[model samples]
Target: DIALAFPNQPRAAVGEVVTKAVERSAPTAQCTAVEVWLLAGGVLGMAEEVGAETKDEGPAKKKQKTTTDMTSARLRHIMLKFQDGAPKTPDGKKVRSKAEAETLMRKIMRDLNEEAKELKSKHRGRKPEDYALKSERFTKLCKEHSECPSAQKGGAMCGDLGWVSKDMQSKRGGNFRELVAALRPGDYSDIVTSMEGLHLLQRIA
Candidate 1:
């Protein structure tokens, strides 16, 4: 979340380091320890500089006045549950173990990068109007399948599925088209293969 929050700076670097720290802490250590460390690091890094001319306010006021701006607020909101370390589902089942959680994180990060790559390709060519999975046939297939998650989400695959080409205007040939063409309804493509899963596609009308 911190990496997503600050894509281009020391925060991203620290976030990467902290992610490794969390991984090492698993099994015997709690993820909260990493969260606390990250929070403290962010606070220290974001602290306002104290100068001799601005020494009018007392230390209490200064501490109280240390503010987080919009980006920090968004980061905090997104990471609100990080300290809790992945909550259980509504049915009270544990979402994933610490190791599983780490794996999920890596998978998601890889997928995000793939999606960005496809988008970058689209930016260079003719951009297609973004389409979503809303076809009735697709919905019904998912609804009837107990194994598919889309069945629980009203038969629609999770958002994040979209088409992006290397050349937006010219759909000559690229990874995105090949990817969408490979879908077979309910089955998702290879993990982290495309912007979305490889086969998790629906006909966008």
Candidate 2:
């Protein structure tokens, strides 16, 4: 149950994707498709002083009907007691903020670099443990934003990480860092290193 708003793509392309989504819906779940701004109108009309005048304009272009569907997924509970600040771990320890998280990530990266150098010196193979550490540190932001206890901590509120420039814009997938960049800042994403496979990611904002 999702209403994905696609910008900059042709309406036909979106409609095709929606049709696929609807067809793939579970038996118990219903789905609908809509084409946005699908309308027809003639050229701009002009009025006459005598009465009403109609100018002979060319054929009317179809209106752009932005289609959106409604589904059953909705939040119902409204908790009056809300707390601010970063969430705590399961042991009730304070978690790190975004800035702190980034700093810690950099430290982790540095440590990993040193560890990789050591491993290369000791043996001529890559370190699985080091790769795991890198993925874990990179994905920490996503996890905290997902299951963290803090109320105000979640969401894509991260202002900027200088990931994307103004010129580049597309929804294509890339490496772990690029995936995070594709989203608005503070959106949760994961970095999973496998032999070679798609990375597991979850949006928390």
Candidate 3:
């Protein structure tokens, strides 16, 4: 069993996606169960406080819950771990040992981090001239193809996402948030892929 935390609202949807991805990547027989823990009031400490406070408030008011209070609860994080037998390859062969599994997970995370770094480097290099040229092209594209499908379909359009916060940018798919955050206002990003599709984001303060 793997325990993950999710917002109560989208628990089902997030759980379904996570379960499917894990099952697809590892042998299903070895993976018996996937569980989600709905983290209320941010973190563990906060959750305890909410529970204690609610209990003290008595049963009458508890039944009359408000939407604002419910929506105010947000998921903090999801922790994933292997359960039962070790993960198996697509060919039905199990991973040899715990050490091996951990090693594999570490390597995968490392590679992902490295890829994010490389993407940032490609876009945010030291040379000023190259950066300016890239920004110019990005601006031109935004003007000429404001309604381009690639730019508009999934999330925000290609250019000027408008002073994106670090947290928001990092949440974008493909781990390109580091690249986005590193960019100064008016700096153009190289082509980046996230769940929202391809983006050529330019920071506009």
Candidate 4:
């Protein structure tokens, strides 16, 4: 486990160090997993700053303030992705253009929403086993179509991300975090653009 001080260092840098530490320790310690705990607000503090600034604004500014507020709310979500079909970008990097990524993500969200409705209808009042089966099916669907960064992990499709506090910075990025925070539990969000790609998120609690 790694205990990281809040407002201490960039998350990406910390993650790199953790990855290297694990790799180095693997030879003798056989490290399998690592956990990180943040000590302070870190990026979450930035969100507070935005909120403070909005407090004295006029009505027009209030509208803009609402946007900022939405961006910093806390949330937990299941994130799925739809990768750009193209194999490479103009720079020869293996990434999709923003437009292409958004289009694909929207399509995937539509499909997932329909499936969610069906699952709810079929299992809403059923036995625990029935609900478990529905959950399994949803997991399978996430695994089959998701292109999320963590999707490569076996049996990790649409995996729960746990509770994210408002203004927190996650591996999913700030925009993604804010998007999730804005949604109600059990709600499906529209396409969210992130550095990793485009995402279709479901807030599950």
The number of the candidate with the highest TM-score is 4
> How do the predictions measure up, each by TM-score?
0.26, 0.22, 0.27, 0.45
Clash number for candidate 3:
0
lDDT of 3 by residue, 11-31 (tens): 232434455566588564444
Better of 2 and 3 by lDDT: 3
Tens-digit lDDT track of model 2 for 1-205: 1111222112322344555676688766766655553121100101011132347654334332222122111110001111237577689977554334333333333332334334434543433322222223333433433232322332332212223322221222235334333332112222222222223222222
What would you estimate as the lDDT of candidate 4? 0.44
Number of the top candidate by lDDT?
4
Q: Can you list the residue pairs that collide in candidate 1?
A: 121-166, 125-167, 125-168, 125-169, 126-168, 126-169, 127-168, 189-198, 189-199
Taking the tens digit of each residue's C-alpha lDDT, what string does model 4 give over 27-72?
Answer: 6665444434332222212223333444466333322122233333
Q: Which stretches of candidate 3 lie over 4 Å from their true place?
A: 1-139, 143-158
Model 3 pairs whose backbones collide? none
lDDT score for residue 38 of model 1: 19
As a whole number from 0 to 100, the lDDT of residue 11 in candidate 1 is 23
Per-residue lDDT tens digits for candidate 1, residues 1-205, read: 5443322223233545566777677667755323221111111122223321345753543332222221110000000011126677899977544344334434443343344334435444422223122233334433442233334553344332234332431242224344333322221222112222222222231
